[model samples]
Target chain A: MQGDERGAVMKPLRRPRALPGTATPRPRHRADRRPRSTLRTILALAAGGVVATGVALLASGGTYALWSDTADLAPATITAGSSTLTVAGVAEHAVEELDLTLLAPGRSVTTPRPVAVANTGTTPLAVTVSTIAIPDGNAQLAEFLRFETAVDTGGGETCDLAPFAVAALTGESASQPPVTILPGEEAQLCLRIGLTADAPASVQATSAVFSMIVTGDQVRVP
Target chain B: MIKRMSGTLALVLVLVLSGAGIGHAYWSAHGELTGRVAVGTLSMTQTGVDGLAAAFTTDVTEVTAPVVVTNDGTVSAPFALSFTGAPAAAEGTGQSSGDLGAATLVSVWPAADAASCASVPAGDAPDGSTSSTGWNAIPPLLGTLEPGGSAVHCVRAVIDPARAAPGDTVVVTSSLTSGIGSWSSTSTADFGQSFSDDAIVSPHSF
Candidate 1:
């Protein structure tokens, strides 16, 4: 009786028959089991790969932390150097009025006033006469005016008209080499101003007010 | 391909930024100065005119006009004088066929004052002398006058009996012009010579 009860409880592995007029049927158990097993294997592999990558990243982080070292440093103070240029001992960007009075036609007059360029900063500088600006309604007069310049590097030399043999127009750059000045050093600049003989009658009794800008660039020296 | 392209673009951006960071760096400063220049004026004026409006007679007569020239401008300038006019005869009068303007001789000379101008001898040419028929050439520099200075000049007109008729009348006009005579240097040293050491000290503050 026990053996019969066991036989009834266990079902037999057998293939089901197809309905009438149907094609040959596939094995449903085998096909469904194969697809489920393949999906579970792929999920298991993906989960294992993720866990292994996390372990590797943690190990790398732990290694870096174990090898790292730090040291304390003292505080440092830094101060920047300065570059400053002055004309006639005047401050930068300040308009220093120079006296060049009684300019006549057909004659050249050297200003009794001298232009002294001084480097009053902590660094050396290269100086250049950058620009000249003429006032309104004086363009005609500027055409006839000529200028010459010379530099005296504190050599106890007299600034005279001999150095002014070559002249240029007011709009043109002065034909002189760039002057290099050290800190606390000064250079004397002489200017000879002339009006051409062909200056017209209209320029008579007319006054021209103009400005000159000088630039200084810091130079590195060994 | 997209990953490779993105890596290449990142590299190019890094190179550009690095290049911009390597530009030159320096400190710069500037100064400015102003200059005022005044030009001297060259001009003159005719303050007064005398002796030019007189009538001439036939008998070798002389008339004198004292003209005054003033230097009105700021600069010293030299002056010159010129004359221009023509003689005309009255209409329907018996006077004709005579050139009184051509025959009339005019002379000019500088004098200390108007009163002294009359004392200048006739036919004396101090500055210049010309005929009244036409304009005279610009004469040599008569004299130089300083600013606001004046000088009296005598203009004498002489008429000859042989060249004038009874009804002939001539009017003369004189013009004065001033101009720059020459250029001179105020420097005592010879040109091209080294100048004396004259130092121009700059003020400490503006």
Candidate 2:
């Protein structure tokens, strides 16, 4: 029985015969016409444009640059302000030179050798003084001599500090600038040099070159 | 499919033209900053000065003379001063190295305008006072020199009575200069160029 039922379900079905007039139904009332029109062309073009625009916007996240440019900076001419520091008052020039010649223990030079610090530029600067690059081939003499700095600005101006230890006078690290000088202004420094009385005989003939350095850091131009 | 392709091509052309049109309105502006910095010079002078016009004699003690240094430039400068005024060929009859006698010296700057300078004692200045010239350069010192920063010097010139007899004469001079002197600077001098930004071409910012 099941085999018979399965054969019936699998049996092919046949279409009913169409009436003569219905066989070619669409042939009736047909006329000469184009499959596509100008309207269709316009519609296709619109669709493509929409798709292209959507893709562009989606890819770039709706961002576009109008105009951009970059230019390098022009070369600047920097007129460096000069810090003119000169030494004065010596025997070659006056009496100060003669007093500094002999380097004996307990020897002291109290005479003022005015070291003038000037800001010879169009700007102001913070000035610092250091005894740097002082020729010191003889370590003994360098260690034996003690130096100090004092200041005198014109009318009775005096600054006396403890003697700077020769050993402590390393690089420019020991310098301190407590003053600011404007352009065309100047300050005078009175230098004092001395030899340690306790220095041993080892430093007898040793010599050392001496100098004071005045550095200027330019201030904002007003 | 062909119609769609044609539409895509048309859209692409439109987008390209629009982009070109936007760029056509592109504008540009320029900004500029300029700097012209020239380092200034540091100079000083000490000529035709005096150490007490009271005259020079055997009885005078150490006194001070005033040295006034002026900076005529715009900036401050340091000067390496040296006492270059040795006796130059001795002038006339009073020209003698030991004529001024043995004397010790010290620098004294008292007050701004006043000096504690040394004199040639009582009596008369050297008969060749006009002949003795002071230095144009200062002794090179180990320090700073500010612009217009001036301090009067009292070059205490004290005669050593034990080393000299009366009636002798002496002549000396000194001055100041900026920087150290090698064989070149002390004896020689050398001499630069720049163009302004406003010279030519378009008026661009500087």
Candidate 3:
């Protein structure tokens, strides 16, 4: 015991001194390692969202206009022209205006009279002649009545086209072809109407009326 | 930051591929359209030379005249030659010999384009099929006549007087049937026998 006490009393007490620029070990706390706010994390997430939205918008914008085109179609229009005809004159004179209205069986009335056919319209017309009314149902009565046309022969009233042609309203006009009249054109022709000697008694006191039908067509633009 | 950028790039790619699956499709922007018709007209005209003023007789001589039929309408017409008002005739000499029914006629056309007829010999009847009951058979000579087209023909008859009787009284009418319409020339043949024999030359003027 006396030796231990003497050894402890003889031990030297020496302390080490800290030199300059020496680094000292520090305590690392969990809280000290972390950033102060969540601003950095929020910025990172927002950047990722921006990239996603950009890609979506670019893809969709291009797809919509790929197969589209436009053009201007031509327009169409339609119109109509006038068509008309008139047969009012007799032998170079207007019959209705002349007021000469008695017809005799033996003599041909209006023999020297020239009938004028006028076509007044912008377009041409096909004119047709017909008897709207005739003397009774006895068609034979019409056969005795002669309707004749004359050309401008020096002698006058003579038909050179065909000799002795007779038009007794034998429904011949009903079978007649249409006559063409040019726009603003007119025709003056000789007409002769008479009851032949063979006319029957039934034909007496008979009357007739004539009418003209007109037709026209449209011309297309070239 | 780099890791975040890379994660964002991957997320964008997934979104793009899934766009169609999420009801995405191409969008497009949109138009409709309709001509004219009218009825046509037809017309015809006819004329004769020297106006039929003379009576036909058995003179052993032929009478000739230029006759023209015109298609004045806008449409083409196929025409038929025909006769109207039956005429009486007798082939024997004396009063009965002047029968116009026995007489034959020739229609010779001028300007080939106007119309056509059989090449009948002079003083001979025209070489064509006769239809005393109805319309005569028209040769292809007269084709479909267009507007402004004309049919020209010379109607002639050769008869010998004295031997050919003088009692024939007939009024022969030459007619053209085009479609439902008809045109006629007024010409009469009188054997100097009777006024009834005279061809009542009637011109159906339009």
Candidate 4:
């Protein structure tokens, strides 16, 4: 009976009865269903292959050139150059305090020791008066004070206060006309500080304390 | 799947562009130095006063003193002279109410020498004499003096015989003041404090 039940379950799947008066039913093979399933599998594999190809092209920087030329040039060992600016033998990031006593109204005083701005680096630098920090209490004195800068080119040139006009320290942070120094070279900077003749009486016997920051930037040559 | 791949590509491109934007840097070096400057001073000194005291009588009623003023400070300023004090009668004279100060005439003039200052005659106004009664008079500016400069001035006083007794004695104190602009006072000594100005550059790394 189990053999007969197995044969009954497989009989319709193995062969289907044709309609009446139709031609004799052709024999159907199990291989007939394989073509459709094989085609679907191939389509899925093709889609996956296309996606993978796209990802490969995108990942390789999208270089579409099929041919490229090669050049065998000598490699360069770049030695990074340095930029250093020093004032009075003192390097940057350091503070030096100078005392300029006996400043009188209608008179100007120059630094006894000329400020030496030296370029100790490997590259040329452009030096400039960057920022001036005047204490809030001495702001009034700053108004009456005049500052002048001159570059001494070693030709008997001196710091002349008569040529000093309205420049730095007159409510301005920096002065104009930046001085440039070559590598391993130094420049003498003369600063003349003058108290105007019309300075008020309140500024007498008072002190003005301030800081000046000078900056030197590396000059890049094209 | 293609849409998702495009989204991934766009995100990667954004990251690459952002990395390129922050690649720039600069090299700079700076030095900073501080400066301190103190203003000079204005002052004068009464170096000498010759014959400041004198006895007066009805026959000889005028006296003169040579006051020497020197600018001892670092600046040039004008100097002025002012007098303060009242005249008093001699002790036990019972003439305490005698008003000799009211009747005395005080005058100042720039003199060439001490001898010439002492020789100024009574009842005669000398050249450049600031003649006035001591009461309610503005101090006279003698002259401007540069640093270490000196000036000699004669201070003469005369008594009016009609307004005072023979024993009345007037002692006057003189004050010397030096002034510039709005600042005026007695002499101020130098503090002798020293200060200086300087600057430095800053160091920067790239």
Best by TM-score: 1
Specify the CAPRI tier of model 2: incorrect
Name the best candidate (by lDDT).
4
DockQ-based class of model 4: acceptable
**RMSD (CA, angstroms), candidate 2:** 28.3
- The residue-by-residue lDDT of candidate 3 on A1-222, one tens digit each, is 698897779867654444677765455887766574466767777876776666677766644456788898898676755655455322122234211333333445443344455656566554444432242444654555555543232323323232223433533453334445566766444455555655544443445443222222223223
Instruction: Note the residue pairs that clash in candidate 1.
Output: B51-B65
Which lDDT values do the candidates have, in the order given? 0.60, 0.43, 0.44, 0.64
Candidate 3, what DockQ?
Answer: 0.04
Kindly report the docking quality category of candidate 1. Answer: acceptable
lDDT of 3 by residue, B131-188 (tens): 2311122232344567678777655443344333445444446655555222212222
Better of 1 and 2 by lDDT: 1
Error of 1 at A222 (Å): 8.7
RMSD to the true structure for each prediction, in A, is 17.3, 28.3, 26.3, 16.8
Q: Give candidate 3's TM-score.
A: 0.29
Instruction: Give the residue spans of candidate 4 off by over 4 A.
Output: A1-65, A74-101, A104-127, A130-212, A218-222, B1-14, B31-43, B47-50, B74-78, B84-96, B112-116, B119-126, B133-139, B162-171, B179-206
Candidate 1 Cα misplacement greater than 4 A, ranges: A1-80, A92-110, A135-148, A154-162, A165-176, A192-208, A220-222, B1-23, B39-42, B58-60, B76-78, B89-97, B121-144, B162-169, B178-206
**DockQ of the candidate models in sequence:** 0.23, 0.02, 0.04, 0.23
What TM-scores result for chain A when each predicted structure is judged separately against the true chain A?
0.59, 0.48, 0.41, 0.57
- Name the candidate, 2 or 3, with the larger DockQ value: 3
lDDT of 1 at B138: 24
Share of true Cα-Cα contacts across chains kept by each model: 0.58, 0.03, 0.08, 0.56
The digit string of per-residue lDDT tens for model 2 on A51-147 reads: 7676666554674659778899999898744433223322112223523344445555543344555555556665554434345455565565555
Local accuracy of candidate 4 as per-residue lDDT tens digits, A1-222: 598998988766645577799898655877655677567666655665566556555654566788999999899899998888888778633223334345666766666545778888888788877766676578888888776666554622455432433347634645556667888888776666778877887787777776767788887654
